[model samples]
Structure formats: C-alpha cells, structure tokens
Target: MELLDFARGPAMEWAFAIFIIGVLWRLFGIFFLHHRRDLNEPRHGGAAPWWGAVKTVFSRMWPRREFRERNTYSTVLGYVSHIGLAIVVFGGAFHLLFIRDLFGVSWPALPTAFVYLSGVVALVAFIALLVRRITHPVLRLLSNFDDYFSWFVAVAPLVTGLMAVAHLGARYETLLAIHILSFQLLLVWFPFGKLMHAFLFVPARAVTGYVFTRRGAAT
Candidate 1:
C-alpha cells in the first residue's frame, strides 16, 4: 500500500534475500577461483600447515610486530570502520528485531544507549574512512571505480540508519526504505567488486603469512 508498508514488507524480504544470496555467491566465487596454492613448495612453497594458517589469521590483527609494520592511516581507518560496523550490525536492537521478523530468530539486543552509540561509532568511522580515501595519495592511486562505489554502498545504510533513528527529513519509514535500498545495492555489487574481499581476506592473509613464515621471512 504505502511506501512505509512496503518497507516493512516486501522491501525487507528482498533485502534479506539479496544479502544472503550475494554473500553465498561471493564466497563460492573465492573458493572456486583460487586453487589451494602450496606454501612450502621449493619454488612457491607448499600450502601452510592448517594449524599455522589458523594461528596466523587470529594473530594478524595485533598492533605490534608485522601487522603494525604494514599499517598506515588508511589501514587504521578501515579496521575501525569494520569493527564499529560489526558491533552495530550484530548488537543493535533494530537489527535483532528485523531478524526475528524475517527469520523467526531472536537474540539479546544491546541496550538502547549502546545501540545509539554503536550507530554513531559506525557512522563516524565510515566518514573517517571516506576522508582518508580522498586524501591519501597511495590509496587514491590504488583505488578503482569499485573501491569508491563500495565505500558509499557500505556507508549509505549507516547514514540512513542514523537518520531513521532521528526521524530526520522524511518519516522513519522513508529513512528505513532508503537504508534498505542502499543495502540491496551493496549486496548486488559485492560479488563483482572489492567488497568480495570480506569473504576472501581471511584465507588470503593466512596463505600469505604461511608462505612468509615457511620462508623465514615472517617470524
């Protein structure tokens, strides 16, 4: 009937479907495209020992040692944005409600104040990332169309979510509609864009670390 009604109905369904399917597609693509490269072969090294690979990923985010050696402001911003967004997505009350409505699943939600704080953190981190991308020369040089598009696509939901909470501009329903629409766009673009890195990054990092460790380049 009305746009608000649609947002709470078909739009929600479509957004959830696209998100699930898109994530699956991206994971599948990464799994199929990358042959298991060996990490210890004499030339290229055989594959890293499985346990070692796991350890590498779990330890890769440490601020000291090799992780910090490679770090830059852009990396810091990216990490902060990802962490904040994960907190908001997994901890927010509205997200829990949406899950209950769509999937008949429920989880404990963060406190209302925490939900608002998480949203603000996610939004601030996202804006910092955007500014970093524009100002950082190396990042700018490395960025392609997909990189720029992915930033906006990922950030749009957070911005609209804040607006939705404040009931700014249009009603909450309209803000929510905009949020869901942006999320759908992100889902559709994910598999074909740099955003697929979300699915691939862990494995990729593991393989790199393993290769270097076996070669005595990383310790």
Candidate 2:
C-alpha cells in the first residue's frame, strides 16, 4: 500500500536524465532534417496553388468544416492517440500537482474519472493505429522498426498506468513503480521516435500542402 516507497532514488534520477537527453536529441534531429527539405519543389506532383496549401491544412483541422474530408484511418488514429495522450499528460491531477509542487505553478486538474477515461481512449486509439498498420497494405509496406517501436513506446505508459490504478498485481508498489518507469521511458523515447510527429506534424503538413498545391493536386 506504501507506493511511494518503491522509489529507486539514484537509479531513477539517472534514468530520467538519460531519457530527457534522448528526447532532446531526437527532437533536434527531426527539426534539423525537416528544415533540409527543398521547399520550392513539390514532394509529389499535381500539387495545388501555394495559397491553397495553407488553406487545406487550416480547413481540415478546423471544427465543423464540411469541406474537409477525414484523413485516412491511420492518420485519424494517430491523431487520436496523440490528442488523448496530451489530455492525459496535461490534464491529469498528478501532473498538475507535480507542477504546483515543484515549480509553484498550478492548472486545474482533470477529474480522476476523466484521467482514467483518457487513458482508456489513448490505449484504444493506439491499438487501432497498430491494427491499421497491420491491415493497410500501404502502411504495412511503410512499416519499419521505428513504426512498431513507437507503438510500444506510446502504449506502455497507458497499460502500466491502468494496471497501477486497478492495483491488480502481487505488489501494488511494483506495478506503480513500473508505471512510473514506463512514463519516464515514454518521455525519453518521445523526441526520438515517430512520436516527434507532435512537433513535426504541423510543419510537415504545411510542406506537404505546399507541394501538393504547386502540382494542382488535392487542395
């Protein structure tokens, strides 16, 4: 019942430090590589006009836009997982309390029920994404180590958190410890993995739109 006692102290500190460094490295790599793309040339042919590219992105992401078609299931699931994870991370009571305690900043905490619901939603969304990868020919063809690893990285925290919440294992402390460790691992892996899409997606979308618009393709 004494969950806090599971702290590994020094080892945890070292692990957290390494994770932070790895995340930074990954983020730097993504932004660095993205900047290298040729902005003038279309990534694919038949792109729309330049202005059209900007319009497309905003229109689709905007609420209640009938003109915007749904993205592919893979894309939708990917966004869902990311959004759900964000809700869990920023809206959770623990994260808010941590910020208040450590940095003297506070935000309204999501209700405990909402926190658990977000975890469930994120888990389902991640699994749906994995299934899309497995079932879709194009996605399966594109699959690589990072693709699978990213799913595992994204799902681990949710699974562990749910287990900890349920208190199902022999040692609740052990389960809680694993949950914390998994969460830390996710943060470390985030910047380096496909999860960096969080940072890169907007830029990538803009570039993709520009390229398509130039070629007179989908707007």
Candidate 3:
C-alpha cells in the first residue's frame, strides 16, 4: 500500500484502537491492583476530601517553592513546550477540521502562521529538555530507556509535521503520511511509558491531596 493510504487507513485505526485499549487497561490496573487501605489515624481535618483534592489539583498549577527555587528554568521549559505543543496539535485549523470530521464537533482554530510558530517553539523546547536530560548528571543517572524512547516517540510527530508543513525532503503526501505515522507510534507507546502520567497524574494528585488534607497539611 502507498504510505499515505497505510498511514491514514489501517495505521491510524490501529493506533487509535491500541491507544484506547491500552489506556483503559492501564487505568484499570492502577485502580484495581492497589487494594491496601491506610489505617493511620488522621492528625486533623476540617476540609472535605473532595474539596481538598480539587484544590490540590488546581493549586499545583502554580510552581511550588522548591520548583521555583531549584528548577525554575526546567519548569518553564516544560510549561512552554507542553502548552505550545497542545496548541499546535489541537488548535491548528487543519487539526480542527480533522477533529470535526472525526468527532462531529468544531471550534475556532488559531491562525495557521501562529500554529506553525507554536509548533516550532514546542519542538525547540522539547529538544532543549532532551539536551538537559543528557547533560545533567542527576537526570542522566535517573534516566533509563523509557525516557529516551518516549522522547523520540513524542518528538517524531513534531519533526515530521514541520517537514510536512514546509514540504521539505519529500513530497507533501509522503511527509504527511510520515507525520501521521509518527503520531500513531506515539499513541501506541503512551500507555506503557511515562507518557501514561498524562492520564495518571490527575487521580494521583487528587489522592495525594486527600491524604495531605486528612493529615492536616496545607495543600
């Protein structure tokens, strides 16, 4: 099959299926595998658990004292890259049309030039983070195969996407196919890797907040 057909047809379908199934399986395993209950007495508590959880989740959006002092640059890079990539992927006019066709919903999209610029910024930030991971002793020590592999999978789409947009190194059809294929690979890798944190962090933060609130610590 042609690259375009394979990417848009079977490959895209496979990626979506694996993404949905893998996410569901991983989530189920997290909730069901952990059955231990905390039996320790609470130190003090006035706030509702739900309220504490909600508060903690939103409060963490602002950097903590330690993050600001110790890793402010890294934190800023993370925010910039993540937010920029999200805009490029979900706020682009082309992407909005695709979303509308697939899901029967539509929304305003950012201008194409802005979307392109955001994608470039996101790619640059991602590369910077990878360089930091490689150069920093502590981060390098903590890093493993999954970290690098996830980085590759995550960045491949951005690189190919830029190539597609610029019509560079190949025909546009081929570049678009490669871009879609890279995204599909990312979806397939998401569930088993640190990428799962995107989905897992919400509940994890909520539980952490609930526990902290029960212990009378400020969230």
Candidate 4:
C-alpha cells in the first residue's frame, strides 16, 4: 500500500483504537484500583472533599506566590506555549473539521492565520523546552529515554505539518501523510508516557486539594 493510504487507513484506525482504549484503561485503573479507605479522620471536621477538589481545580491554575516569584518567566512561557498549542489543536479550523467528522460535534474555529502563527510559536516553545531538558544540570540528570522519545513524538506532527504548509521539502501529499502519521504515533504514545500527565494530573491535583482542605488549609 502507498504510504498515504496506509497512514490514513489501517494505521490510523489501529492507532486511534489503541489511544482510546489505553487512555480509558489507565483512567479506570486509577479510579477503581487505587482507592483505599482513609483510616485517619479529617483534621478540620472534613467539610467539603468534593467541593475542595473542584476549588482546587481552578485555584491551582495560578501558581502559588512563592513559585510565581521564583519562576515567573518560565511559568508564563509555559502557559503561552501550552495555550498556543491548544489553540492549534482544538481551535484550528482544520482540526475542528476533523473533530466534527469523527465525533459529529462542531464548534467555531479560530482563523487559519492565527492557527498558523500559534503553530509556529508552539514549535519554538517545544524546541526551547527540549533544549532546557538537555542542557539543564538537574533536568539532564533526571532525564531518560522516555523524555526524549516523548519530545520527539510530541514535536513530529508539528514539524511535518509546518513543512507541508510551507511546501519546503517533499511533495505536499507526502508531507501531509507524514504529519498525520506522526500524530498517530503521538496518540499511540500518549497513554504510555509522561504525556499521560495531561489527563492524570487532574485527579492527582484534585486529591491533593482534597487533602489540603481536610487539613483546613487553602489550596
């Protein structure tokens, strides 16, 4: 089969299926298998576990004062890069069209020009992050194969996409197929790697907030 057909056909199907199943399995395992009875009593009468979780979800979006003071630039850069990537993935016209085609759901999309700009910025941001990981003493010491692998998979789609858009390398069809295939690889990798943090962090932060609330402390 031609590369394009394979990428868009069976490869896409299997990658998507694995992505969905893996993510669901991980989530179910987290919620079902990890529960243990809290033997200890709440410190402050245990008033609002669920409410605390909800509150923490929004509260922790902004960094604490100490962290903000220390890493203000890094934090802001992270947010901008993340938000830019989100705009490209979730708000781009082509992306939204694909979402609609797959899920029968539709939403307004951002302008194509903006999406393109955000894509460029996100590419730069991820490159910077990878450089930091490689160069920083502590991060380099702690890094492993998963770190580099995840970065490559995360960045591959964007690089191929930008190349396709710019018509800079191979034929447009080939570049586009590479872009889609890279994204498929990303989907397959997402649940198995640190990328799972995208989904897992919610429950984790919520539980942390719940504990803090039980102690009568603010999240």
Question: Runs in model 4 with CA error above 4 Å?
Answer: 45-47
Alpha-carbon deviation at 2 in model 3, angstroms = 0.9
lDDT of 3 by residue, 62-149 (tens): 6888677868778888989999999998988888888998899999999899999999999999999999999999999999999999
Q: What is the lDDT of residue 19 in candidate 1?
A: 67
Q: Which ten-residue region of model 4 has the weakest summed lDDT?
A: 70-79
Identify the runs in model 3 with alpha carbons over 4 angstroms from their true place: none
The reply for model 1, stretches above 4 Å from the true place, is 34-48, 63-72, 213-219
Q: Give the TM-scores of the predictions, in the order they appear.
A: 0.80, 0.71, 0.94, 0.90
* Rank by lDDT (best first): 3, 4, 1, 2
Q: Candidate 1 has which clashing residue pairs, if any?
A: 38-46, 38-47, 39-45, 39-46, 39-47, 40-45, 40-46, 41-45, 41-46
lDDT of all predictions: 0.74, 0.73, 0.90, 0.85
Q: Between 1 and 2, whose TM-score is larger?
A: 1
Candidate 1: clashing residue pairs, number: 9
**Model 1: lDDT of residue 203:** 85
Which prediction has the highest TM-score against the true structure? 3
The best candidate in terms of lDDT? 3
Give lDDT: candidate 2, residue 136: 79
**Model 2: per-residue Cα lDDT over 1-219, one tens digit each:** 344444446445666687677767766776666455445754454434667667766755643445336445556676777788888878888768766865798888888898889888889988887887798788899999988997897789788878888887747788877877776677667766787776766766786777667765665
TM-score of model 1 relative to the true fold?
A: 0.80
